[model samples]
Target: MGKTLAEKVWDEHVVRSTEGEPDLLFIDLHLIHEGTSPQAFDGLRLAGRKVRRPDLTLATEDHNVPTLDWDKPIADPVSKTQVDTLRKNAAEFGVRLHPLGDIEQGIVHVVGPQLGLTQPGMTIVCGDSHTSTHGAFGSIAFGIGTSEVEHVLATQTLPQAKPKTMAVTVNGSLPEGVTAKDLVLTLIAHTGTGGGQGYIVEYRGQAIRELSMEGRMTVCNMSIEWGAKAGMIAPDETTFAYIEGKPEAPKGADWDAAVEHWRTLVTDDDATFDKEIVLDASTMTPFVTWGTNPGQGVALGANVPSPEDFSDPSDKLACENALDYMGLEAGQPMRSVKVDTVFVGSCTNGRIEDLRLAAEIIKGHKVAEGTRLLVVPGSVRVRLQAMEEGLDQVFIEAGAEWRGAGCSMCLGMNPDTLQPQERSASTSNRNFEGRQGKGGRTHLVSVPVAAATAVRGTLSSPADLVPAGV
Candidate 1:
C-alpha cells in the first residue's frame, strides 16, 4: 500500500520507532515565542541542559510585544517581563532571536515562511497552537507544550504518537466573493469543533491545489480550531515560487535539488487516508461565527441558530451558553449583527495578500460613523511593502488606523483590545469568550467581510457595499 503525505514525512523523520512505544521524531525547525518559551527555557536551566540544536531553533517576541510605540519600553509590566525574559533566554542559549523592531520580527509563523525557513517535507514544531500554519509548505508541523518544548530543546527530537490521516477534499472553484477563511469555517461547522481529533488533515483536490500559498496558510492556520493535530497541503509550483529567492531559501544547486525533492512530497496516487471528507467549494459563501467557537458559524446570510436546532444535547447546551455570552438571540440575521470594532490582522489572515484584499474594498471608501477599524500588518516587512504600495494611505483615507505589524487585536494580550460589552468583526482565528478582551464579543470573518463590516458597521461583505460592477 502507498503511504499518505503525513506518513511519508513522519516516516522520514523517525529516528526510532518501537511497535508498542512512541516514535522519536527529529524536528528540523523549532520556533519559539515569548508566551510559551519562558517556562521551557527555565526548565532547561533548572536541569542544567543547553539547547541541543541552537542553529535550528529561533526565538521572537510577538504575543507580548506592544504594536504601538514599539520603540518605547512596554508599559504593561507583565508583558514587558515576558519579552525581556525571551531576550535573556535566547541570548544565554545561543539561539537566534528577532526582537521587537527588527525587520524580521513578527508573528513566528509569518516570519518563518516569509524568511523561507519553513519548507516542504520538514518537521516543524513550535510552542504555539497556530504552528500548524507552516504545514502549508507540505511539512509535518504541529504545536508542543512546555514539557515537550524542553524535550525538543534538549534532544532536538520529540517522542510522539502518530496521528491518523484525514483527507479533506475540496472540489470545484470557489465563488468570487468566497475565501479560504469561509471554506475552513464551513468545514469546521460541518465537522464540529472536535471533529478532527487525533487526526492530521491533508487538504487535497482541485480547489485546494488552486489556492495561493497565502490562502492555503489561512486554512492550515485554523486546523487546530477543529481539533486537528495538523493540516497540510502538498507542495507544488506555487509553493516553490513563494519560497524562491526568499532570504533563507536554498540557492543555486541547493534550490534545484530542494525543488526536485519537494516534487516527490505529494501523496502517492494509490495512497489511502484513514478518513475522508469531500466538500464542494462552489456551495460555500462568506462565513461568520455566530457563537463563541469557530464551529458555531453560518453563511453570511444565515440567522443565529436556536439551541433547539441541534439534535445533540451537548450541542444545544453549547449553543445556549454561546448565545448568552455573545449577547445574541436565535433567529437574528448574522448579516446585520452590529459591530463596534473591526480588526484585519492575525497569523490566520495577516499576510500581504490579506491586506491587499482589504485595501481593495477600503479604497475610496470610508468607515461607518461609529465603527473603529484597525488595519495591522502581520510583519514589519509586510507593513513596509504595504506602505510602498500606498495601501496604508488607502486605509488612512478610509478613516482606519493603519498600525504597525504584530499580533494586534487578535488576542487580548496587547493594548488593542475591545472595551467591555463591545463587539468586533475580526479576521483572526478564534472567537472563544474574551479571546479579544473581557466582555468583548467576537465575530470571526474573512478579510472581505471584515472590510465591509468596517464600512457598514455591521456584519457584511464587499458585495454588500460594492455593486457587481463599477
Candidate 2:
C-alpha cells in the first residue's frame, strides 16, 4: 500500500528502529519557552553535557512574561526567575534567544513560523502543547515533556512511537461569517475530545486548501485539544507562498530546490489512512464553546445544551458540571450570554491576519459599556506590522487596550488575567476552569466573533452587528 503523509515523513526521519522498541526520530528544530525549559536546561548542567546541536535550537521568553510594561522588571518574582534562568541557559548553551522587546520575541510557536524556521517535512518539537501550530507547514510537530526536551537538547533526536494516521477532509467552501476557528471547533464537537487519540490528523480537501496559511495554522493549533498527537496539512502553493520571503527562507537556487522537495511531501494518490472523516464546510456557521471544553460547542444561533441531551453518563455529568461552573442554563440562547471581557490574541489566532480582521470588525464601534477589550498581537513583528497598517489606532479608537506581543490573557501565568468569577470571550484556545485566573470563566471564540462580542457585550457574530435587511 502507498504510504500516508505521516508514514512517509516518519520513514524519512527514522534514525534507528528496533523490534519492540520505539523508533528514534531526528528532530529538525526544538522550540523553548520559560514555562517548560528550566528543568531541561538543569538536566544538561547536572550531566555536564552540552547541547548536541545549538543551531537547531531556539529559545524565547514567553508564558509568564508580561505583555505590557515589558521594559520594567517583572513584578512577579517567580516569573522573573523563570525568564532570567532561560537567558542564562541560552547564553551558556550557545542557543539563540529572543528576549522580550526583541522584534523576534513572541510565543514560541508564533516566533518559529514568522522567522521561516518552520518548514515542510521537518520534525519539530517544543515543550508546549500548542507546538502543533507548526504542523500547518506540513511538518510533524508536537509537544514534548521537560524530560523529552532535555533528550532533544542532548541528542538532537527523540524516541517516539510511530503514530497512526487519520484524515480529516473538510470538503466544500466555508460559508460567509464562518472561520477556521469555527471549523476546528465544529470538528471537535463532532469527533469528541478523544476522537484522534494515538493518531496524527491530516486536514485536507477543498475547504482546507481555500484557507490562508494563518487560517491553516489556526486549525492545526488546536489539534491537541482533539487528542491528536499532531495535525498537518500537505504542502501546496499557499504553503510555499507564506514561507517564500521569510527571514530564514532559502534564497535563489536553494529556494527553488526546497519547493520542489516540499511538493513531494503529500500523501500518495492511493495512500489509505488508518481512519478517515469528512466534513462539509458550506453548512458551517460561526461557532462558540458554550461549555468548558472545546467539544462543548454549538452554532452561535443555538441554545446551551442540557445534560439530558447526552445519553452517556460521563458526558451527561460533564455537561452538568460545565453548566454549573459556567453559570449557564440549558435552552438559553447562546447570543443572550453576556461577557465582562474580550481578548483577541494567542498562538491560535494572533497572527497579523487575525488582528486586521478583528480591527476591521470593530472599527468605528465602541466597546460595550460593561466590557473590556484587549487586542494583543502574537509576535513583535505582528505588532509592528499591525501598527504600520494603523490597526492599533482602529482598536484604540474602539476603546480597546492595544498591548504588546506575547501570550497575554491566554493563561494565568502572566499579569493579564481574569478577575474571580469573571467571564470572557477570548480568542485564545482552552477554556478549562481557572485557565485565565481563579474562578474565571472563558468562552473560546474567533477573532471576529471576539471583536463583535466586545461591541455587543454578548456572545455575537460579526453579522450581528449589521443592520436588519441591510
Report the Cα RMSD per candidate: 1.2, 1.3
- Give Cα-based local distance difference scores for all models: 0.93, 0.93
**TM-score per candidate, chains pooled:** 0.99, 0.99
* Candidate 2 segments exceeding 4 Å error: 466-470
TM-score of 2: 0.99
373-401, model 2: which lDDT tens digit per residue? 98889999999999999999999998999
Where does the lowest 10-residue lDDT sum fall in candidate 1? Answer: 461-470
- Relative to the true structure, candidate 1 reaches a TM of 0.99
List pairs with backbone clashes in candidate 2. none
